[model samples]
Target: MPRFSIVVPVYQVQGYLRACLESVLDQSYGDFELIVVDDCSPDGSPAILDEFAARDERVVPVHLPANGGIGPARNHGVRLARGEYLLFLDSDDSYTPGTLRAIAERIDATGRPDVVLFDYARTHWYGAVKRNRDAEVFGAAGAEVFTVAERPELLDLFTVVWNKAYRLDFFREGGFAFPTGFYEDAVVVYQTLWTARTITLVDRVCVYYRQRRRGNALRTPSREHFEVFAQYERLFRFIEERPELARWRGFLYDHMADHYLFILRQRDRVPPSSRPEFHRRAARDLRAHRPSGHRLGAHIPRTSFTLLSRAPYALYALHRVAAVKRAGLRRRHRVWRRRLRKVLLALHGRLVLRRALDPRLAVYSAFSHRGVLGDPAAIHRKAQEIAPHIRSVWVVGKDHVDALPPGVEHVLPGSRAYRRVTARATYLINNVNWANDLVKREGAVHIHTHQGTPLKSMGADLLKYPGARRGFSVPKMLRRADRWDYSLVANPHSELVWDRAYPCGFVSVRSGSPRNDCLVRPEPGRRESVRQRLGVPDDSTLILYAPTHRDHRQGGYAPTCDLERLVAGLPGDHVLAVRLHPSLARHHERGLGLRDLAERGLVLDVTDEPEVADLLLASDALITDYSSLMFDYAHLDRPVVLHTYDWDTYLAARGTYFDVTERPPGHVTRDEDELARLFASGAWCDEESTRLRSAFRARFGGYDDGRAAERVVRTLMLGEDMAAVPVVPAPGAPSDVLTRS
Candidate 1:
């Protein structure tokens, strides 16, 4: 018998069937059998199945004579399954790579549990992937193996059959089968969970549940959704049959009501004409399932339950309409308020622009008003110290207000104060271009302290790669560049690139990076303090992995390096610090599983750490892929390993300034194996790596002499002449000891 049997019930999923089949067939663990059940599919799924079966003997195609539904099709596959474990997969969904191996390992490690539940991510058609919100439930199980009685919260997970692997003997002994209907899997999922002797969980994401934009049976409006009542009815009957499961009646009732109400509220699911009848059926079911002395859960509003149980459908309909209207009114009021605020701000800004510039006032922003970060923040701090008369005000987004340091004055991006400051401030500083609506006054000084040296094509250079351009307007970009009085360049290469990319009249000041000044002369004990906070040992080899954002995969985080594989392959003392690009950090945290890994002491997720320079100082070496942090990290003179896994793809999709592979700062490895080997063999920080890093540094590491911020402060804010500004120290000079004279 095979170790596992994957049953897939196919209907009209022709678009996704091939990927589903191949996901299973291409698994590293080859002991599983693929049972593709054709539920009278009208599409070309049968032909695809036949094609796969002809090539692979592991495929067992079962064609139904007539359409019985997904439940019956799965039952037929189970009857033929000879594997020790039975797994169900939806034809539209797919298993992630190494899913079966991970499951098999978890099963063995947990002593062959009767049921194994795993996490899944919702893969959208628009290239965005979000992990299940309740994924933490897997880790909250509190043990490797446990029963439902020990952790009933497992029932809180979505009622789905595909995210689990069931021992065939245990399933057959329990006589479990999916009920036929719209929610066929609900009864089966609850039954297996409630009855299983031993249940375990795999915290990793094993499945990519494709959320289709259309053609989804559940999302379609129809009376078939009433099958939910029948499914819950079966679930309650199962509880009735076994009096021992009577304690879970209240919880099950709550689940059924929540599910019913959710379906009723969704605009696309229950039609307006059928809502009254749907509510009537739901009320009847809620009354029928109410256990003796059972009270509704805290999350379920008591008033909602009372209305569903007692109020007439007409009354309930009136209540729902009123609730929706109130919500709509609230939304409209908020929109009106925002519009009025914008109008007022615009008027205030226009009035303020007529007055003389506030020579002592300076406005700072970074990352397009993301927060007070990068060069702008560094410059702001220095101005506060040396040019105390200059009042610094930072413009940040409302969501990122907390990113501001204590006692720092800030205004929201679109506020009246923000507009007034933009209009009146004599010195305006930003790492990125201000909003498109920004107007440059005659006498105002606009300093563009760029975020980093460009490794990829930027500005007008992006005109060649339309994908990289991503709706970039060259005319508007140059207009913003035209506002610049001075452009801060870290090195000669940056000055040349900035001149070509942004054709502006601004003088290119080779003033180095104010941000890297922290790297050159970090506060004493900062490195150790940061390491301690991150739980990294002083003796460990801290490898900071910071990959740049890919222009092709916008709003997505798809790193080519398998983080788990890389971390597992490394020595126990070696800790990996993962710092995601700011753009992808918030959206991809759950998908990356960084929190879980950090808790396990495997890797440090320093993505949210306000200062990137602090992370550089805390790490022993850096691992990057085309991120300009590699250039900044070179200032430390540390070993840098280039993980160029998708170099060719990135180069084609988003044109780079030069081929990094040809002249990398350190050893360049294209695969995780090669990357792991470099660290294991001590080649990551060897003589050749140092030699390459020295050459790369000489080219890109000039101008940052631990006093870039001081120089900028003296020149712009303090009104010091360029010649009078502190001269950059010579190469190999003691940067840490070079204090203000």
Candidate 2:
């Protein structure tokens, strides 16, 4: 008998089915049968289901003649499952390799939890992920037997269903099914979690929830939020039915507040006049009080008086003025911003003629601006729009000699006296790590683009969480990144998140990197060409193991990869391309496991290489923990093995900004034995290989396309002819550390 039965609900999500099913079939822990119930989908989902059922005996596809939302379909599938443990997988999302294998072992070790809860993750724009780390242990209890009003964490059940695996006996005893028409998870989470006798939390991030952009499931939410009203009513009724939970009264207050936030968010769209009355009703009806605190206030205005009431065009204009002033956007070396804007306007007349000749014309947004002197991402991006034809600029100080763009003269070294750089060059840009200025208070056109990405609370939220001494100061960092004249941002939501975290400014929207953008595009055997260029063997699979360094004792985070087992377990043909994070790449530890592996000639360290992308492209897999580079590789369609040894502390320090169960690309492990077993057979099969490759590309896409450089050139430099501004020299700037004498 199969060890586990995966119950999948097939619905209208035919667009996302193939990859979803393949994820199940590819599990490194292969002892599982798939039970698929097609709830009469309107799309071509049925045809796909039929094809899958005929092709694989492990798959038992049930076709429901009529549509009965996700609940009934999952219920039908659960009934047909033959394994002792039941795993529910959404037809639109997927599972990582070794998910079931790990969970099954965990189930046995932890004494058969009614429900085994694991981390879940989701990707945005079908790209970057938002992760949540506090995935919990829940049990299988009747919906009417437990009340969520007491457990706020279970509220997350608001989003997903396939985030866990459960005991078939418990599920059978509880008689649980997705709620008929509304959210299935929401109806079950609280009841399930409350009934658990023993629940385990896997430190590893396991599932991948693919976010479908077009539909209004949650993005730009609507009246559907009100469904919670009925759901809560049922919860209240359930608790009343089961008098046992009267002791956890605190959950009641929390649920009331969660439900209140849900309702108030709904009323925000119904105009100000209707909102107050609606909120008043929420206060009187839901929580029995007036709404107060940071997010909402009837009397308080969102903007500052000096900027909001006095500035031109109010917010947008203030945003622009602040960007230019704070970031010092002009590329020309003129000390005065007014003079630089005038110079740029003079050059615009040239583009005006071209615009007249060709009506299809628009201004190009500058994607990068050196903002290291100040804000990390608030690098002034549209400097050309304000200083067209302006190029080469002077540094304010001396720290930035080698950081400037090629062909651009940085700063004359040994020049503490060059205070007034009125005639040197155009735009004195600051790279992200130069002279850090985080406050939005600085009136300069300094742009910022952060060096790395890991959203929740790593570097910026250092001080806020538990292990902050090793991280940077949050307020100071925000202020430094804030000093930029304008900002180059990834997405609007990112902007919103950043704005909420710091000060507001002009943001230049960007999709990806100006430098490493090549990773996202199909190399079309480019990896092979790159391998040849790098002088690596052609027949070997490559594994790039890179880890960041932190003060171990204080940091509480240590490398978790099983290097000896990994080296021993890897096929002789496979090469371990061990590249450590530059900061920690030094061979400081004399006899580290990885070092031993390298001594044995099983791996080679390439941490000092200028960029990791070329190596990543040529490689077959990556292994790391907490570094955001993994997200970038998600687009590469390669397998990844996570080695996060310090899982709890990392989450506590910086939150899991996204759901984890949905985003991990490969298996996550703690020691050498497990890692050895995984690579040995769990993931190397031909069918497993196809499943892994297909699931990866389905969510992340195939390539970077190499056009980003051209795009950047035309958009920010060459096409804009941004080469005529005079230099403004300052002493000791990183972007200006004495280039000229």
Candidate 3:
């Protein structure tokens, strides 16, 4: 028998069924059998399930005779389970990456508990993930394994069956089966906990319980919500049958009262016409199950419980209205306070702009104030080293300030201090343009450190492709560029491109790329350290698959290459590390199967990683499609493969400066089959690929020499002449090729 039997009850979840199945089938710990029960789904879920079963032998699909509810379908799956432990997952929900491995490790550590409970987060349809607020309940200290009585607070957790794993034998012995109807999980979850001989908590988020915007059975207006009362009745009956479990009577009573109030609050769940009867039934149950000398917790208001039991529906409605109004007033008061604070800050900033410039202050930002990263971060570090007199302050988004390195001072984009520093600072450096509203103060210098080489058409060059110029305004771009005192270019090609594209008055300096310095002169043991952190095996050939964002693609990222096919066809020693463009990172967690591949050790999702330079150092080769990262990777003399599956479409959508297809850095492949063949046949890093890379490097890799940051600091910040700055090393010089074990 397998270690785990994950039972998923499918209904009309055609949209989410595939993601859910992939989440299970792609687990890093593969010792699990997936039991997918199709409850006569009218939609396309059955076909999706059949497709998975045909491909993977581990997937076991069971078709029910008729359309049963979710509860009965789960019971059918459990009856067919043949694994040591039974776990349930809703067809619409999904397991987080490495969830099964984490649970298995926790089980072994806890000496095989009968039931292991783990935390779950709510993933909204609009791309927001929030962990359970009562996650602290799982943090009970002491023995690794214990009874429900040892940590009664676990009862406070959400009554969901999917968050916990039950030993198949223990569950079967207790005859724990979900009841048919709504709120069926409550009784089974509570009974399993109270009956289990041993219980343990994982204290980690194991599941992503998706909160759908529509088509949720419980969220719809229905009288089935009254089924909650029957579910609680079954729980109380089970407790009475086993007198030893009666200690939880008071807790159960309070839980029932809280759940009733919650249902009443959900206006969509309980209809307006049936609420009066629901309220009457709730009051009757409250009186009937009122445990003697049992007081509600301090966190819950006593008045609410009293009102639920004593008052009529009209009185309760009035109280709810008053409470809502008070809450709204408090929210409005907080909003006004925040607005007033912003107004005062703006006034103070305008006043500070009137003062003389601070020669010592330098403000830096990258990727339009997203974070302290890329060329701006490199220049900031270099300035502190050689130009100590200049105090550096990084401008970042408010949400990203915490990610800044320790001791690195930072200011939020719209804060008063950011405005003050931007106005009076002698040096303003950024890889991307600053806010359009920025005032170009005299005596202050603006240095536009271009982030990357222009493989694609940029700035005014994008005027030809209307799709590429979606939100771009050439007039506003030029106005921002007009404030620049200097434009740092990595090579002659970049200088020429910037001259035509930006058409600004700033002097273009061949200062090289500060970010690429790490590629040319990496710190000792840097490659090994980064690879170890990324969980790359010593024998593995790390292929960094960093793809560029497509302007024509709307909604979210659609992989240009068939990642699954490529991974499956490659050699076992070759590992694919995927780094999606920053613009697509937010959508990756939703539908992209990268997380599953990442958990399985076949792929690594390093999109959120701050430093792209570190990823470059960790990889043996790069596979890209029109990304400037290939230009930086060229300095390492590594093989670069261009996967131009959509070459014609991309050129039409977002025109490029040159034909990369004709002058690719290395071997080019238009499909995954050919891409896999190159890696399998060792052609990806062969002599022919290296020769192509050599010529490409000679053209674009001249400026980076491990001292670009130092040169930029000396010339721009320290007021040193270009002649005094370190000269670029001659062609065919010894380049640093990071060796892996």
Candidate 4:
């Protein structure tokens, strides 16, 4: 007789269903009945279950006539289960190696209790890749303590059913059945966990949740969260009807607070016209349904004429706006410093003292000839690859040595710095805007790897080096641009974009860019490595919040949020880490607002680190504002969030090179709460993400594969031609190679 009936409910996980079933089938611990239920999935899920049943007598495939959500579907499967214990597994989420085996061992090791909970993990949008250890993007996190109502003040437990396995008797005792539609599982788990006789919790992750998928169920913002009171009224009515559980009012009140806060947050997401009604309905629901008198709405709503006397929702809304504005003003300096410093560093870099931890790169460019400049990660990585090959390569700038990666000996640049470096180097490649006349002066083959996308030339650099020699009417400008002897391009995509953008800049084309091309390489198990390193529980959804700088250069765009919406809507196990651009590095520090997010222990600021990819790799999804980094995150195929509050101003100032929101990389939120709601919906590896990523990647050069640097270097080193480079990625990224010259 089977000891456990592992209930595997299937919906639409065709791409991953095979892997999910295989993990269960491959479990080292046998003796468990495999109850695979197909909830009328249109995909290949039914076929996989049929195959499983045909092969193994222990496998029982339960088919539902029509599509019922997980609750009803699982209940149907449960009726057929014959084991002593019930283990629930979502069809889309997979079991890791030795997961079921581990659970079986735990049961055997300790006499099985009424409840057994194991952990799960998330996969990033990008294929797993190695990451800088310090970024704190993904790693092992501690397992939540889920013991029987220990602390009096502690609220009702967040009931995640799939994580736990229960004795069949436990279900029979409480007579558990799912509540029906959306969030029904939550209702079942709440009563079930509270009723459990004994429970066991383990930190190891067994399930691998696919994250940031474009169209997941939870992505839709529900009216349920907005109509907070009505839902709670029903829940409370049920609670009151069960006078047997009368003592749990305190716990239920806390739950109600959570509901109110959740709806409060989404006040911005719902239609503005509907908000007054949404609020009025919410107020009525809260007023009608109560555990007794702490009437939350009454305290703030009944008598309100003063500034603070307004409705609590309105008061908090205004407070949030004020707080956001105050924070923007406070962090304005750091934001200003972050933005303004880049230009200054490009100009005065050769003459200033380098800070101890300078992330700036001293790249050589063909377009801007005056000062030493930096562009993208490609130049840094390529230089590293070829650094050993070339001896005495001159490094010119005030802090040039700080930027150099451990090996090369350096020379600083002055007005004559170019002459000094040019004299000593084997090749003075134009990685940034620093000019070089290798074809004219010293027989140096100057590789022109221009920084930025091809297509349009709105900048002075584009006007100067319009790619192939159109020969400028102005002698000085022509001489400076002609300093580039050879140019590089990523592929036919970059080839075409640059053709129109740089009509005269191209001397010759090579298949390289040390700066932007390294993203294409295969990432060798970096996700797991970083996940293990970060100490994140294998099951937590690692989210990265990456917002770009505003073009107007002032006024931090304030976005709206719905905390209750996320808490109520998102899978309870996920975690969000917000990493704003370095340009806004000071924003967090300037106000107690964002810093307090750390107090809640959700957001992480990674700008202090040298590289952003480490954080990217660690994250399962990327939540961002309007920034080019979205493209970098896109390569990972992770979920991307565009939290653009000031889209009007941003478009007016710096129009996106392409229509960014057409296919929409991920959900676009005008408010922080909605953005959070979208972030709560993890990464995707299915059809939806496939379509979004394919369309988005088309606009930029296809260099997201971690190996972009390798391709670019191989192209340039063998004297191949390169067109204009893709927009520079973050610093300290993988090495870019221009291969197979």
Note the clash tally of each candidate: 0, 100, 0, 98
Q: Give the total clashing residue pairs for model 3.
A: 0
Task: Show where candidate 4 strays beyond 4 Å.
Answer: 128-146, 151-159, 221-248, 263-278, 289-334, 337-741
lDDT (10s digit) by residue, model 1, range 415-465? 677878888999999988988777899999999998788889988888888
List the candidates ranked by lDDT, beginning with the highest.
1, 3, 4, 2
Alpha-carbon lDDT of model 3: 0.85
Tens digits of per-residue lDDT for model 3, 1-741: 999999999999999999999999888889999999999999999999999999999999998879979999999999999999999999999988778987897788878899999877788887667667776666556778889888877887788899999999999999999999999988899999998889988767778899999888889989999999899889989998999998999889988888898898888899999998999999999998888888876665577678888899889888888989989999999999999987887778679878999999999999977787898888988998889999999898887878878898888887777888888899999988888768889888898898788899998898899888887797888898899888887877887799899887887777788898888888999999999999898888999999888888664354567676788877889888899888776552322256545644568889888889889999999999899998999998899999998899999999988999888899999988899888878889899999999989888886777887888788878888767766574364323221110
- In model 3, the Cα lDDT at residue 277 comes to 91
Model 1, position 22: C-alpha lDDT score: 94
Clashing pairs in 1: none
Q: lDDT of each model, Cα atoms only?
A: 0.86, 0.53, 0.85, 0.55
Candidate 1 similarity to native, TM-score: 0.83
Candidate 4 lDDT by residue in tens digits, 291-340: 56554433332322122223655765576578668779879978898789
TM-score for each candidate, following the candidate numbering: 0.83, 0.44, 0.78, 0.42
Candidate 2 residue 214 C-alpha distance from true site, Å: 1.4
Candidate 4, residue 478: lDDT: 44
In angstroms, the error of model 1 at 139 is: 6.5
